[model samples]
Target: MSATGVVNVDDARVAYRLHGRGPAVVLVNGTGGGDGHWGDLIERLARSRTVVTLDYSGAGETTDNGAPLDLPTLARQVAAVSEAVAAPHVDLVGHSLGAAIATVLAAERPELVRTLTLVAGFLTAAEPRLKLTFELWRRLIAVDREGFIQILALTTLSDKFFASPLAAHLDALAQGILTGTNWEGLARQVELDLRVDIHAEASRVRCPTLVVGCAHDQIVTRARDLCDRIPDATFSEIDAGHQAYFEASEEFAAKFLTFADGLYSPRRLSSSVS
Candidate 1:
């Protein structure tokens, strides 16, 4: 079973959950989502390694001062969680916005990060597609949240997923977003997404890093370039969409665990290879 707790970061109470027992691994969430989005991945990874998932300030169970979101502050929040849960260095995995924050953390607080895994994470706000998408997303959130979620689903999952019976889950997510969550927090995060540029910091990351790109991702088109900017970063592609972790959970977890084991447990790494 996972143990849940909260840590005070600045004025915010950052909520986190820890599970399993082995080398530590921290999973970060994307924009407008939290640790809850990682249920499937957590279940799989927690069996072998200690897994920590954090809810950013103003999202999930974490509480904040309701101030505008920024990369430095968000990165610090992640660092705090890592410091509290992990012994010394913890393997870090991030998706989308969480990836960006992880990059900043890996760069700024290199001592706390053992290895870094970035899934569908961009390094900067230079992508025209992302800029336009977030702009439209913010507008839709203010004017029509239901419509915003439907549109979000369009970009997150692939066409194959939409054709599957699981597509109903998107509707459920949309309904949850309509009734749950704070718009101010989301708006601040969207603004942070537009402004976050961790190129300088990401370039400084010296740890063994893996960049996972979605083959059919419609959201972030610059995953390749994002990897390129990082110093000696290894890149891999998943045959899914932006939400590949959800669309292809087994493949996603396999890729991540393979990389993680290679760094922390040579025995597990060799066993997996055999």
Candidate 2:
């Protein structure tokens, strides 16, 4: 739940958390959110690997000491996490914009990454309507944070998430997002968000990849088209939306771990004594 450790990178102390204990996995969260956004999904994959999630430069409890927040900068900050942890050939799992960053990292550092799993991801600047959603996020953060969270609840997750049974969870999710650090860092993230395309470089990924599209995503439709862009990609479909990580946690985990395991050669670890 907390960052496993923090280290200074340039002007910012990037905080990262590690889960599980075998091969490594790094999770990237959505806009204005942090590693915690992966919810139970990270917990599930940790069953067989050393999964790492981070509080981006200013997001989560990780505070910003003032660093560049542009697209390339954000991309490298994540790269720094891989570097700091000495993760050798990682499998990256990212959701929404987090998926975008994971793809960029896979593109630039193919050697460091063994595979990539993108959930609810995209190349929005490449989409006219999707770019408008980025604008709306800017307006909300600039004018109304709570409103942003409320609607984001609608956009990222599904109507089912807001339906009577799951409605109460909204308060808890809001608290997490509101309480996290990175106010200006998040804003800077948004500014840089407007300039890039998640799809532009999808074709560049050379590692084995699995792109999962939520069959009911409300935030970015055509998640499949985005998935189709990857050259060496495999695909799966979950019956949830942006927050499918929460909605379909178990199914997502099973599929993710299986896909990730396929990327690596067999290894031997010390046997657990029963």
Best by lDDT: 1
Candidate 2 per-residue lDDT over residues 33-92, each given as its tens digit: 755566677778777878888877547766665655655556677888877777767778
- Residue 156, candidate 1: Cα error in Å is 0.5
Clashes of each: 0, 2
Candidate 2 TM-score, true structure as reference: 0.88
TM-score of each: 0.94, 0.88
Clashes of 2: 2
The 10-residue segment with the lowest total lDDT in model 1? 265-274
Q: List candidate 2 stretches off by more than 4 Å.
A: 1-3, 65-68, 198-200, 265-274
Total residue pair clashes for candidate 1: 0
Q: Assess candidate 1 and give its lDDT.
A: 0.84
RMSD of each: 2.6, 4.8
Candidate 1 structure quality by residue, lDDT tens digits, 1-274: 5798888989899998898887888998898886556648878888888888888975788888898888889889989988887479898999999999999889888888878999999977877888898899889878988888888888888988888888877767777777787777888888888897888888898877899999999998789887899888889999889978888888988998878776557555323222
> Looking at candidate 2, what is the lDDT of residue 29?
82
